[model samples]
Each structure stands twice: as structure tokens, then as C-alpha cells.
Target: MSRLERTMNRYRSLRCSGIADELQELVAHAEANAVSYLDFAEQLAEREQQVRERKRLAGNRKRAQLPPGKQLEDFDYRHQTTITKRQVHALLDFGFIDNRQNLVFIGPPGVGKTHLAVGIADKALDAGYKVLFRNALELVEELELAEMKGELKKKIAQLTRFDLLVIDELGYLPMSRQARYTLFQLVHAFYEYRSLILTTNKDFTDWGEFFHHDNVAVPIIDRVIHHSSIYMLGGESYRLREKTTAG
Candidate 1:
């Protein structure tokens, strides 16, 4: 008998996890000239390979780290009357495209802005693009830290490395003069070089207020909007629907 057969016999006597019983039955069959150790070993190896494949896929699923409550399949394209389903599908496809153009999703709060943004970002990841998602406020904080440590340039370079940088909220906070300057510098660096997805409640005309003044805002807006596809999303608050339904 081979080492595998010896091990199986020992395990059979110990009766571990019922594999022993199963092995015993197989061994009895083998002894009766019915089963072969090579076949059993091949089956065991195949099962192990399947287990490893499952673990690999699980890790990929988790690392993708998509939005908590949104998925491509879950998007209600049927109710989105203004935008055709074909256009929405095209937008999703754009996320995977390699031209590296900018995309903007403008809409009011709770209108699935983040949902579509995240959904696209998830697609980008699958297409082998590196993506970074953060709110404008959080990005400001990171810039602040970088400035304090005298590593602002390095941090800006890091941000530029991502294939897609998603800024979740725009115009939510009135940025200070310094933050405004830093944001402009960041935008200027990526001018026509990388893709960005910006979600904002305010339209282009009102984006100046986000800088707390017009002077700094106009240039950034001009640079961002120059070569971008803009999508105006209009819909009732999806969150409100959940609340009403729950009530």
C-alpha cells in the first residue's frame, strides 16, 4: 500500500470528522477490488484545488470593497425615466473603458449619486484600474496633513497615481483659502492626465461657493469641466423611500 493508503487507514481507525468512515468504506471497496487509491487521491486533490479557488474568489470579492448598499444589479434603471436604460448601461461601460476621460455625476442628496459613482468605481476595479474613493472633506484633511508634514507634493503625486479618484461630496463645506489653493493644485496636476468622478449637489454655476469665493473656484471648475462627460441625475430620494416603507 502507498503512504496515502497507510495514512487513510490510520485516519480511518481514529474516526475523525466522519472522513474516516467514508475512507473506510472506500478502502473496503478497494480491498474488494472495486476502488483505487489513485482515483481517491485525484478526487482529494481536485477538492483541494476547488477549495483554493473558492478562497481566491472570496478574497477578490472582499477586497473590491464596493459601496455598502449599492450594486449594479440593484440599480433601478426602470424607474429612471429621464435617462434611457441604454445610456445608463453605456455609463457603466465607460467605467471600464481605457480612454481615461473624466466623469461627473450631479444630483441632489439621496438621489443615487453615490450609488452610481460607487457602482462605476467597482467596475473600474474589475477592469484592472486602481481606484480611490473619499469625500471632499476627507481629501482636504489628507492635504492638510501632507502640508503639515511638508510632504504635500508627495501626497499629490500619490493621488495622481490612481486611475480613478472619486470625490464623493462637493460643495458641502466652504473651503478655506489654503484648502482651496491645495485643491486647485491637485486638480491642475491631473489636468487632462487622469480620470476623476466628482459627485456634487450643486451645479457648475454654484461650485464657486465651495471655495468660499469665486476667484479660486472658476479655474478649477474650468479645468475639470473642460474634457468631461456630465450626467445630471434627477430622482426622488431613495433613502426616503426606505424610511416610508419601513414605517
Candidate 2:
């Protein structure tokens, strides 16, 4: 009912949580330091902005679905010398998302395909891009179920909304006919609308074997490769190397 209580209540109602938290402490500091009115206002605004920025980054990270601890800096680039340092550095610029281009990483398992995909997508996430990451098999399974449930179109629409889509571990299993069809539809829809990243363990020549349906696989490859850069990686498994050293 008092003046100060009424003022604090108004700040809470306006959702100025950072200002509410720091008001009393900052006011004391301002008085002690003989701060001007403009300086005090700037401090209050800065505090609120910092709080909002932190929340934005956390939300972006969650939306990106990047596996934990897979940053480019943490990746052992020296081991995967096949990928040029300049090429790896260029990806973090996140320009491909703006240009609506795609990237493909083709290599054997344990050569850091997934790590590179996640790391590059992480940079986009930090820049406030909406990203979705899913294992290739998981995406195919979901699409298959959607088709069976007569929700294929709607599911593809939902996926196309993201700024970037990272599908990891392609060609690791034989895709079903329905899933292949669904995936083709997705690529066609995303063409020139959003960027995408695909990491596969098989060569382009062998991609048709995984789809098991030439008509479907070839189109997927054509659409994906039409506006994409492919990175080839070759090296011993970093995991195996680390284990050998630790032993």
C-alpha cells in the first residue's frame, strides 16, 4: 500500500524482472556514486538487455537440437586433415543459411561427420537461426508414420519451417518406399526456401542402394546436390585414437 511497494508491483506487472531485481541495489549504488539520471537509466536498460539475450540464446540452442559438447573448437581437426581448415572455418560464417544452399558431409563412420554437422549448425543457432537436427533414420521413420497416418503433407510443412535442417547418418540403413517418397517431397519443398545439412557414410554412387528405389533416390540426390557443397572426410576414428593413447 506504500509508495515503494506500489512502484515495485508495477515493475513486476510490466515483466521487467531484471529491473525489479536490481532496482534497490542499483539505487543505493547510484546514490553512493553520485550517478546522473541518464547513467542510471542506461544501467537499468543494459541489465534488462543482458537478461533477454541470455534467454534468446538458450531458446535457440534448444530449438537447434545440437548434441551437447560438439562445437567446432572442440573437434579434433588435426586428425581429419582431409577437411581443409579454411573450409571448416568458412562454414561457421553461417552464410549458407542466408543463401539457401545445402552442405553434405560424406565419409566413413567415426570420421566426425555428425560432429561437423552439429558444429556448423551450432553457429547458426548462436546467430538466432531456427534449426532442427534429427538422425536420418529417425526422420525417415517419422515420415513413414506420417504417410501411414495421412499426415505426410502436414509433417513436411512443419519441417520446412525451420531455417536449417540437419539430417545425420544418411545411407546407414535401407529406407522404405514410403519414407523415400516422403524424403523426396521434403527436398523438393525445401529447394531454395531453406538450407539443409546431410551427413552420410556412403559415396554418392552408392546412395541408390540405401534407398533401394532408384526412382526415389536419384531425385533426392539431384535436388540435394543441385545447390550444395560436398565435404569429404577421411581419417582414423578419433575415438579409437584417444582410447589407444589412454591405454
Candidate 3:
């Protein structure tokens, strides 16, 4: 084989798939442009870097399981007046994840709580952080199953692996003793170490009712909010607005 073909094979073997795949096209572009050797090398390196970044983000998105097409840009701040555009833009910077902080979005149903959470989560995903989006019931059920299977530790370890975890629709269902304890344990596992974004329809005062009592609720709320930034959203329901406009 030719020397260039051999080099391409070497790049492939080195796991530089980007360079290997774009080798010929880049070389042709360099030749057509009559670029200097230094410029050609820079272009090649830049292309490989871009490809690697794209792959990294693609893998992050796949692992995150973020909702498709739910992005910060699409969030209707005009309708979600409580969640200000300024605050949302600030979150897009994703410094909270770096600081290992928590974000809580509390509001009634359909007030764009999950949308904002998902939007922040999308930004987190883009910012090179591992993210997971699961509803409160789903998370509780997983914890319950883990306890039943005697795999609670392992599950907690896995859950804590993500840089950010977005738990949506919290308090929509009442928690049993096991579920409440499990939820507490899960939060405790990640507390002060990783970031979490929670969206719930219930207020902090109503958490006792949602968790079924005050005694078990104190530690859970304390740990989560002790280091959290709470944004109490108040506004008309976005879903209703959409439906009304469509009608």
C-alpha cells in the first residue's frame, strides 16, 4: 500500500478515527488551497479536535438520556416569567455543576418546571458533564428495587457517577416509608459531592405530607436544600397556554 494509506491505517490503529476518516478530504482541501505545511497540519489537528469533541458530546448525550429537542433556547421565558431569562442564561454557564451545588425548581404542574430542569440538564450535557434525567417515581422505584435486591450500595454508586442528576415531577406521588428512606439515602449519597436538579409541584412546607410525615422528612430536605439554590416559580401553565393558543 502507499505510504499515505499506511499512515491512515496507523491513525485508525491509534484510535484517531477522526483523522483517519477525514484524511483524504483534508489533504485534498490543503492541496487545492496550496496551504503551507504548517497551515495544513494546523487544519488537520483542528479537524481532529472538533471530531473528538463531537464524539465526546454525542456519548454524553446518549448516556444522559436527555429529552430530545428540549434545549435552553426553546424555553419560553415570556410564559415562564417566574424563571427569569437572566437566571436561565446564568445557569447555562454551568458553574453550579462545577461547584457541586443543587438546584430546586418548585412550582405547580405544567408551569415549565421540568422544561427548565431539562434545559439546564441539556446545558450540563454540553458542558462535558455526565447527566441523568429520571422522574421521582422512577428513581424511588429503582432505589426500592436495589434494596430488595441487596444492591443498594452498588446502585447508589452508579447514580452518583453522574455529575448532575435531574429528578423531575417530585412529590407528584406520595412516598412510602421505604421509598422515602431510599430517596434520603440516595440524596445523601450524592450530597455535597455532585450536583442535582429537582423539579417538584410541592412546596418545602408540604414535603412532610408528601413524604408522609415530618420526622423522616427533615434530614432529606435539610441535606438537599442546605446547599441548594431554590427558585420558586409562579406563573401560568405553559401547557395550557399552548393548548389554548392552538385552539
The best candidate by lDDT is 3
RMSD of each: 7.3, 2.3, 2.2
- Mind giving the per-residue lDDT tens digits that candidate 3 earns over 57-133? 99989988877767778888777787688887887778788888899999988888888899889877778889999
Off by over 4 Å in 2: 29-43, 243-247
List TM-score per model, in order: 0.72, 0.88, 0.90
Deviating ranges (above 4 Å) for candidate 1: 1-65, 95-97
**Residues 100-215, model 2: lDDT tens digits:** 99999999988999999998888888888889999989998898889889999999999988999999998998887777888898889998899999999998899889888568
- Candidate 3 achieves a global lDDT of 0.89
Clashing pairs in 3: none
2 or 3, which is superior by lDDT? 3
lDDT of all predictions: 0.75, 0.87, 0.89
Instruction: State in Å the error of residue 132, model 1.
Output: 1.0
Q: Best candidate, TM-score-wise?
A: 3
